[model samples]
Target chain A: MEERTVCEMCDNPPEDEGYELPLCANCRDELSRCPFPLWVKLISGLVLLLVLIAFVNFPSSLRAAAAFERGNKAKSKGNYPTAILEYERALARFPDSTVTMAPLAAACGWDGDLRKFAYYLEKLDGREIRADLADEIEEILLEFEDLSEMEGDEQ
Target chain B: MIIPGRLIALVTFPGVIVHEIAHQLFCRLCGVAVLDVCYFRFESPAGYVEHEPPRRISQHVLIGIGPFIVNSLLGAFIALPSAVAVLQFEAGTVLDYILVWLGVSIAMHAFPSVADAKSIWQAIWSEGTPTLTRLMVTPVVGLIYLGALGSFLWLDLAYGVVLAVGFPYLLVSLLT
Candidate 1:
């Protein structure tokens, strides 16, 4: 009996027409002159996409964290404008963060932009606020009232 | 032909649904507008995702083989915990058996259909196909053909068993 060699891919015996790489005739034709090109693209593309997703998300998350730290440092230095810009940039990358929003409201209030301060405060409404932050916001509101009274007297 | 397809679909309804969903998910991911999606029907094709053809060959390929990638991975992931239980010879709970069944069903349908293969072939031969892409897809096409042949001899089932049971066992053993 002749020793029949097997196709490496499917583990089936090679057809009468033997080929290199221990492949059967059908596998050779299928591989060299593929009838189903779309599948090749699909499988390869998906694997690439999976790899890309894993690579992309990690660095972007790190960048967002760095931006948040920069915003906090700017806020601490009493540079309200720079802090606002950093906070806005950070929020744009990672939106709906209460941590960023609270400091943003404080920055707006300190910069004497009551309208923007009120907007950020409204966003914080119904969410948990620390006792010290709430007292600071109350002080800002009292300051706004005093400014409103002075403007009324000037008018 | 209709009868056979319907019979197969009926027997493997979960696989059919997962297969169609995989195609639809890829279509959306590739930014192709989905015209229609029949997740499971009594028709010959069983289920289908009709969408606008993708502009690039890479996109077309991704959309075509999406199910094989998604289903196989999902099946293996879902089966891992249950696979551990089985390896430890724990009492076969209802949920464990269900997970194994679901995993096997999903994995068994990981191979793209012949129609899908034909569509991919046509795309490969179409204008502006890169030589590198052509070279890359040859072996994949052969493997797909092999998968089709394996289906006839219960090799697809064997593959599911390997993914759900064998691979998990190997992993658990390595970890221990």
Candidate 2:
């Protein structure tokens, strides 16, 4: 008697040629285009609902990001108070973030808030930063220091 | 000890569906006609997307890795806030837990199956293939095998946790 291998998927006689996986003609065809089950529709609906919930909560989820964006925008326009406020919000969301710390220090220095500038600069000490960004921060610190020195000399 | 693939599929049915949808979406994006898509079912493979042979190696790559990109990004996006609230700050609600589960499940199924690797292998080795594409695809195929093997060892779940929890913390730090 010739040996026959059954289709592991559908339990029918298998075709000699096709995919490496064992399957009958019908099962192979079904593999290509199986009819959708009602359960699939229900599950899809549930997934959609989950996605919708995520979308709804997107703004809340990215609260820190939004604040950070606003901070950059305010800083670009030279609005120091708003910039500091936004950067502070970003920092609260990410306390250990050196990215926020450097920027916050820069904004405080520019705004002439010496105490906060010193505090943040100290906090940012030895924190790893991108070389290019570190250069920019260094330049800003020097300029602010020069201004503060000039004011003290006049006083 | 061998656990049936179908049981895993049934447990993470949502992820399986998303994985198939991701494959089908990539097929559409690559302009390959999808002949069949089994989103989810009580079977050995759970879900699959069958498509016509792609015209280019890039298309083949996109189709093969589509699930990884889609599932990981989507999972991270959905889990960002919830992960922060629940894990980082420890101030999450019931809804946050649900979102965390949903996101992690999607991320967990990001790995491409061994079948996808086999198809990619054929595409790379076939006549008229560029050497660069062949070289590039070999490691990718290796990764698919690794992911398949790792799935058995719960590597997929670990990836899910990273996407759900670690990704959120990273995003928060990158803000601005």
Candidate 3:
């Protein structure tokens, strides 16, 4: 009698194509896709998660931080218009951030846009402002009021 | 000594069925010819899907790990409502417990078998494999082995519990 070889998986004797680690035909078929590469599936899954997050508009603090950084860079370069736009974008993401509001008010003041400066200052009025920025804002508001009075006198 | 593979299979039949179904589903989606499918058997694996190898290595990879993706997601989804009910102190019906069991079973089977890890390694080293493929497959192979080892420590059950309970709890907290 020919010796029967056992399958590694189910321990069934191989009826055909018997060899070392002899898998029965059924077991061999089952093992055909063994050691399936998981990385490909994981990458695809991660891509799906990113797409889902994008669709869901998940709140991302990183986005707010990036916008804040862009605003700061623009402000430091004396580009008040770009700073204002970026600061507004940051504030839109993080609505209640005093850090964002302070920069926005400063940007508006630097741009000599009195109306927007007053708008942002009024928004900041009830909230506690940082000492340095508060001093600058007070001076800018006073200068704005003085200019407005001079224009009224001329009229 | 005879290994109690059949007994284990009987105990976790839902997982076996979902796992095989996931494989078949991926094979169909990948356009691979499904030669055979055993949804359940008295034998060791309990269930399996036999399909022709896909033309692209990527497709092959997809077919192999497809069960993990399908089972985990399906398990989590099915468990959501039951988890919510249980958290709210509602006396869930027998069907709810069954759903929770089914979900956890499916999730527990989400880890690919050791054979799957080997297949992925082979695919990674196969001829004409892209550099990107090698880069991506390396970490996955490591994780697959890790998960396989974790199974010995009941990490698979832990993973299932997280999906069935932790995820639902998180969703509820977020909404409220």
Best prediction by TM-score: 2
**Docking quality level of the chain pair in candidate 2:** incorrect
Clashing pairs in 2: none
Candidate 1 total steric clashes: 5
In candidate 3 chain B, where is summed lDDT lowest over 10 consecutive residues? Answer: B84-93
- lDDT by residue for model 2 over B145-173, one digit each (tens)? 99999988889989999988887566666
Predicted candidate 2 versus true structure: per-residue lDDT over A33-140, tens digit per residue: 444568767866776676577556555556866687778789889898999999898777667667667777878877888899889888978877667657766887
Estimate, for each residue in B1-176, the C-alpha lDDT of model 1 and write its tens digit. Answer: 12354675687676777787788777766655565677778887887877645667777788779989988997786565565443333323466566667678778788887767767777777777898888787666667777877777777767777888865555534432
Error of 1 at B49 (Å): 1.1
Candidate 3, which segments miss by more than 4 Å at Cα?
A1-155, B1-6, B87-90
Please tell me how candidate 1 rates in CAPRI terms: incorrect
TM-score of chain A for each candidate? 0.60, 0.58, 0.57
Residue B139 of candidate 1: its Cα lDDT? 64
Q: Per-candidate DockQ versus the true complex? A: 0.01, 0.06, 0.01
Error of 1 at A52 (Å): 27
Could you tell me the lDDT of residue A62 within candidate 3?
35
- Candidate 2 chain B: worst-modelled 10 consecutive residues by lDDT: B84-93
Off by over 4 Å in 1: A1-155, B1-8, B87-90
Clashing pairs in 3: A34-B115, A35-B115, A35-B116, A35-B117, A35-B118, A35-B119, A35-B120, A36-B116, A37-B120
